[model samples]
Target: MKKSVTILFAFIISQFQAQPGNYYQQSAKYKMNIDVDAEKFTYQGEQTLEYTNNSPDELKVVYFHLYWNAFKPNSMMDQRVSGQGKNGDSRLQKDGVSRLASIPKNEEGSQNIHWIKQNGKELKFEIQETIMKVYLAESIKPNSTTTFTMDWDAVIPQQIRRSGRNNREGVDMTMTQWYPKIAEYDYDGWATFDYIGREFHAPFADFEVAIKINKDYVIGAGGILENPQGVKGYESKPLLSIDKNNKVTWRWTAKNILDFAWSADKDYKVKSFDVPEGPKVFLVYQQNNKTKAWEEAQPYVTKYFQIMNSHFGKYIYPTYTFIQGGDGGMEYGMCTMILGEAQNIKDLMGLMAHEGAHSWYQQMLATNESMRPWMDEGFTSYAEGYTMHQLFPEDLPNPFIKTLDSYRAFIKKGIEEPAVWLGDHHDNGSAYTYASYVKGELYLVQLGYIMGEQKLAEVLKQYYDQWSMRHPSDRDFLHIAQKVSGMDLKWFHNYWINTTKTIDYGIKDIKYDTKSTTIILINKGQVPMPIDFSVMTTDKKIITYQIPLNMTHTWKDKDMYGDFSTMPYWPWTQKEYTLTIPYTKSQLYVLGIDFSQRIADINMSDNFIEVK
Candidate 1:
């Protein structure tokens, strides 16, 4: 008994030590000056970055991301879109041919580095497509800071992907990933993957940006505007002051954000609304019949922040913007660039809800998204579904019903990859989209099924309070889940993320005796989950049973859908379990598993056995 107690104490300490705060992440501070030529559709900029090494290991090398370079013909992004053919992004292809290959040279995007210096000494650097690696002349020691300066120029591509100029909607520019951003280095080492038109990951840092452009343009950006009073659409609405150069310098600053993005258009209409106890909301879009949705969405946008904060957590930033510029909708630091045109009010509200929810998971949570796109996209989708249900309660039988069916169909195709696959490495774009977005949402929905719904909400709040603004990994999230639910979630995380497994449970047989009834439940799918079985008698009374997986070591305190008696643990190794209840055959109306419909059981047809 003494030895057992000692081991248990040691294990508890180890688990506590393994929590998220054990590791360190580097930080960056950037100051930039940019000059744009609207007619030529290009820009030149200079940057000075102060990088702090928080890791124990000394850094001998640094890398940067030249994201716009991927818009050039024959680039990796263009090739990937081409290779995927009909299975790839529909925007990149036109009638079975890659549109990137046919784009004119003037429309193709490119970035050129003029010079780079480290601590006043020129450094040797190489550009491999979208990534630039700089060999350090003086390595940065542990806990030391290094300064690097660079001068570069870029031609903004015609609006094809996220960052570009001259979009179809006539927005002048959408500047995201427009600068030569330093690559993030964490415990996993340098994440310098080439930009392949997918997700991104970057260090949490501060940005001070100054842009000199014609005074006629109105801009919406990620950070707080330092010169809002000088701009026409701001609160003061002061007259524009033009210098001899006929240009105005717009200054912006953001703190502890992973990325800085902005959009500019001469005709943009700027509007603002405030969320009570939350951030101020900004809507920047063109004024037209097509953009009427933007004006209508202001109230709904404010309500979204309130709903998300009351349920998920508080919005960390003081302001959020919904800009009209990008191809479809893309989330940024403090703003999201969404297509201005909306089919209707519901369509506009849906997009705003999804992108707004992304601020919690993508902007503040700051997960290494390229490594785990599901954590960002999936969690964002889950929040969006809930927000939509709240905003439009008329369609609230189950918001996740469509997502569950989508995941089941993808699984049936036998082509779905594990959710653990890198965001850009997935073989099929459709598979990647479904796996990361739909299946990832289902992961949370089903967890809410296993634990009670109220407990799941508490777990999410706990996670946000602990991990926000820190670069959290999958283990970090799962650890919070285990701590909150008091259930072992290792098996759950492994089966759902690291492998392509399916969940299918069915009522295989039913038997009646003189005093009671017996039912056989079978696990037809490889993946195992806690079971919620319900039996309805002829008199309309319902009885529910909870069968938890043995791996969890404990079951939920109560069922969310109805009252249920806790049954014995269902050992995953055993494919079938015999469940006995105190009811005769004549008393039975229907016997079903997971009547709540929260579980993603693929074989729902066999889930219920009904008697007339």
Candidate 2:
């Protein structure tokens, strides 16, 4: 009986360590054929969607995102940007006027769907700017597969946002979100969001795409190019083309990806190099004097992939491209669109590191950006900081000082919103960035403070390993963290993500007798956390102590800085913690709280005291 009970306990522990299997996310398969007129800045497309309904409930309706429609004059995305006024995204504004509204009507973006069919039966559909809602001809049954086919064409708008033609950097076409992408439907039902201005979310799928365009242009995309011999720099020699219009049809295929985006340029110079133990790194940009930095950025970006592959889990994609395009830098599935005219290597490589790190959190982990952007953007930002820490030398106490700096600056305004707010529903753009990127990165650093830094590292590896292809929400990640740390972190998640509560722990008072020194730690902020403080004695010995939160039910076995003694648990209800050190007043030099600066304490003035 004893052996049987032990086996049962081991089984329970193994279940928590393994990937739990109830998230039945629907999957999609895409087959698209696109023909483009480079001069007209337009394209015609035929798309076939093979969708599987994995849910228990039958689907009555479905939707797709015509993302390019957001670039129209009076579209929902334009209105959302125009409404921000003074706080609008600077990229979408020029001297406070909406660039989207100023686009020429002929040059404006439009997607006119010719027809749609469900399983060879005609289905009714309505286009409301960027979102397409389709009334199903027949209710899709649970655990069933269905096919939807559509024919559409669009006049690509002049560059205003992520997907457009002829961006500010002189790239010919930054083609992203230029297709009729099907909306993701998971346990939360239809994630049919209006194109308001952030990123997107989609399920993993296979793509077989063929783009026909003028032979003069060079193309780069997320998928592996099938017939690349004739395309510019993709293969060693040119292959014969049978078309009479001086056009080449670039065939490409990608397996198990979320989205497909591509770019075409008349002067695009493509360089393909293999990262040792990483993906085949491709640097696609227009070579000019201004793009000298693009060449220098290769080694730095190569090292980033190696570091991420070693530090995090292996990068799932076989090829990763750093293509030159977009307003600034935007991350896609296996490639990133970055502006190419930068003159310096540091700035250019810095941009690539941040966007490239998105492969892990944004593309692979595949969180819904609209709902749980913190898990995507914030996690990517953390990976970026680590990459920069490796690629360049930062003379700081820790790698997260920039995030801490941003967090410190943003908290002072008191205009911060709860991170739980949806990506597009922020009070302003700056607030969204702070809440998503800054606060999100700070979440990991603070977790290192709560859970040991070693444990946080363990959590990252396990998270990437288990949730790479799965659409993990905040709860799913927290579950992995709890399993790794052996602690309940709901209180930590509640305060940091669910509320605008700040953290400010301080050394309130200190006193000493002949045998021991008494120190009082006070929690001035609403959010309470496990404390790691240090004391430098007059005897010149630096001593540290860690006080675990009562809710944690366990303490960190090691510390990042040095060795520390485990003190009693600080109950969340208690505002003050008294610590006694076996040192006299004459032997103490100074007492400080969280001297390593890992915690995001809003105030630092009272965290230290000179023990005279």
Candidate 3:
């Protein structure tokens, strides 16, 4: 019987290891074809994709994104356009042209052609969708390869957001997202969506892109240059071709990348540094407006790159560029577009640190930004806070230590809102950004406190390794957290992500018996954050206990499980907790719940109890 049980256990372990969702077990591959022209600052290209369907079921359709459409007039994205100002009118008045309104509407299209093989005969299929589609492509066999061709065109928008055309005198025009690209389709089906001034999730693929530009222009893209010997303005030369009009053509090939972007300029100042055992760091900023501050900022940005690479996984790309453009700091694969202005050294470092960290969440992990914006944006925001706390400890705000102050400030002004709202559905224009960015970071900080920092970091690394270049829902995150913490956290999730409840627990009553001392603690708020309770005896000895509760998703009662023999660790909840101290009635004591105010307890009036 023992021998049979051992054999069965081995079989089950092997089966578990063979599951398709195990990203670490299998290698994901992609290939792309891109061609660009610098004269008109636009791109027309074909992407040949070969995806390995590792899943169990057959996939019938694929999705592609036309993100430039978000900049169109009368679009949903057009409603929230503004410039640097406190009020909407000030932003409008400062810049007569609404950035969204300035996007060129005439140049965006994509078509997918399917390959068919029947009875030794080869055929092709074509289908096109304005936004996205479910086409009848050949069923991709399990653990096999299916190849398709996509042709697209993108007219570069005038530098608005991160991806666009930037025309500078004596400088080469920098163009990005100058072509339509296919979106990702997996267990969740099509993931095509318009750009909504938020995060981005792209499908992983290899890229072989060639651009034609003037001979004087120098181009940089997501990958290394294949053939630099080709003459300007020709298509039939070699691997990839360029055209005349002094336009330089660039051909790029990338492997295991989700998206592609490139920049070009005749006068671009290119600088490179080797990162030990990692990708090379490149700085591509124009020298026209460069200053001493700018020169000093580059090293700071590079330091952040080192910090992020060490904390997260290795930087996978061969090179990363810090290009100057757009309104502020934004991230592209293997490159970041940053605005060239900062008030002080701290401000400059902060911007660089935040943007560089995006490479981990937005680029490396590549979570879908449309549906689960919180995963990329919120997670990155949390990382930003963490990085800031580590790098600029004196200047940055400590979310864990100042949770109460944050809650009080938000509540006292009556600006408190449910943190569960959709990323694009907030009433005010900036509210969504603030909540998703700041509040989301706070949530992670609080989670770190609940489940020790080391455990939280482990879970984060696990999450990135598992879901990189894949789509994971909100539930997936909670599931991973539960597995990492070894505790069921459904109640925590429901309260934190699904409701607007606040946390307010305090001492309700105190009494002493001749044999022992007893105190009653009451939860005063609807929200149920884990609690910490501390009490002092008349002799000045302190005691602490942690109380676990069921308030968010469950209503069951059970004894809390945690070591309470320590002096400073206590947990309380929405319900009352009764504590019996091992002391006599002659002793007097003072009791406090969440004495450090780290849990953001909304009310403190009931936190203290006196016993005589």
Q: Which portions of model 2 show Cα errors greater than 4 Å?
A: 1-21, 240-242, 538-540, 610-612
Residue-wise lDDT of candidate 3 within 412-515, one digit each (tens)? 55554455675545554345554566556666765665665566677787777776655566676777877887766776677765665677777777777788
Question: What would the TM-score be for candidate 3 when compared with the true structure?
Answer: 0.74
List, in order, the clash count of every candidate structure: 0, 0, 34
Q: Estimate each model's TM-score.
A: 0.94, 0.94, 0.74
Q: Residue by residue across 183-210, what tens digits does model 1's lDDT show?
A: 9998888999889888899989999999
TM-score of 1: 0.94
Please give me the total number of clashing residue pairs in predicted model 1.
0
CA lDDT of every candidate? 0.88, 0.87, 0.58
- Kindly indicate the candidate among 2 and 3 with the higher lDDT: 2
lDDT of predicted model 3? 0.58
Q: In model 1, which regions exceed 4 Å deviation?
A: 1-21, 395-397, 513-515
Question: Against the true structure, candidate 2 has what lDDT?
Answer: 0.87
In Å, residue 413's CA in model 2 sits off its true spot by 1.4
Question: lDDT (0-100) at residue 12 of candidate 2?
Answer: 88
